[model samples]
Target: MTETITRTTGSADVRGLSRWTAAVILPIGPAAVALLRYFLPYDTVDDSSTMTSKVMAEPGRMSLVLWLGFIALLTLVPAAYSVGRMTRRRAPLLTAIAMFLVVPGYLALPWLAGTDQLLWSGTEAGLDANTITRLAETPHPTVAVAGVFFVLGHVLGTILLGMAMWRSKVVARWAAVAVIVSQPIHFVAAVIIPNHTLDLIGWGLQAVGFAVVGWAILRLRNDDWDLPAVA
Candidate 1:
């Protein structure tokens, strides 16, 4: 009886942790990133010609942003795990596939960010512009392959995961739809407005969607905990 009670308590703890992770931390990464991209100091051309000089001008601020970005990427693991868990009961295969894609996609984000930071730091250390440009333009074949994986994983995985969540009915239907359409809407708005308005829409959608998911988790009864384990 004691052993059974202990096991039950452990399972409950896991469920609680997973729920909080999904509802709270999951949304922070994308929202923070969107804010960073749109905000002052960190704001600039996506791949500007003057990157070296920019890095030299504000090395401290750039370094802080880089570390913050890394922290944001770290939140993806728990977010993905909770998402997989919530959808597994209704769409096991889809959830598993989404996890496979998204895990690598998020993992690659920090690596890419870190790589960029290192290049900029190197420039600050008097590295030649030609060498930096060449390196950025011609990444290793493996890095290039990883970049492809990163892009596909995020784009395709989010769609699949959002659909799975919709089918699972784990969150509000509108919230699921918001998650599904956020990226495309953001992309379109970015090209059209080319301003912070895109960031507001992009991050707002994510915040609302994740908040709904979290609210739903908070409402879960003990009976709901009998669902399939997250693979």
Candidate 2:
């Protein structure tokens, strides 16, 4: 009886975790991402010199970017995991692929971007302009590879996950649409807007997608909590 109770408790914990991840962490990540983008210094990507200058000009403001990014990164792991759990039964293969891609991709960019910026913010006084320029301009191959994965994860993974959710019929159809449409919408907003004015909109839409997904997960009436059987 004790053994059976322990097994049941473990299963309940897993279900609870999935629900918490989907409902809370997932939505929080996108909102944090939006806040990070909105607070970033202007034209940090313009050039090496411009990037260095901006970092030095406002270290305090730049520091906020790193903090926000850290929060986003923290939430992304569970968000991705919840996506996997939600889709595993209906679309196992695709969901597996999405998790494989998104886990690393989503984690890498934020950590790398945050580290890259923090280096400048933390030690502007000790570092020289030439050093800063070199650090800023030098291309790290690892970062390039990570960027590819990150793009694939967000673009492809999100779309696949959205499709899986739709096909599963566990969530409202419009929720799937929100998750699917957010990426391209963000891309278009980035292209059309100046000074990243639409960044809030883009990120806001992503948060909405997660929020809708969270709600859908909460509404799941399955005895299994819609979780796939783990071997």
Q: After superposition, how far is residue 59 of candidate 1 from its true place, in Å?
A: 3.2
lDDT of 2 by residue, 153-206 (tens): 877777777777778766778777777776666655544453454676667766
TM-score list, all predictions: 0.76, 0.79
lDDT of 1 at 129: 68
How many backbone collisions does model 1 have?
A: 0
**How does model 1 fare in lDDT?**
0.67
Best model number under TM-score: 2
Which residue pairs show backbone clashes in model 1?
Answer: none
Candidate 2 runs further than 4 Å off:
1-14, 43-45, 126-128, 189-195, 226-231
Expressed as tens digits, the lDDT of each residue in 50-109 for candidate 1 is 555566566776776676677668776677677777789899988989889978887877
Query: lDDT, candidate 1, residue 192?
Result: 49
Candidate 1 ranges beyond 4 A from true positions: 1-18, 39-48, 186-200, 226-231
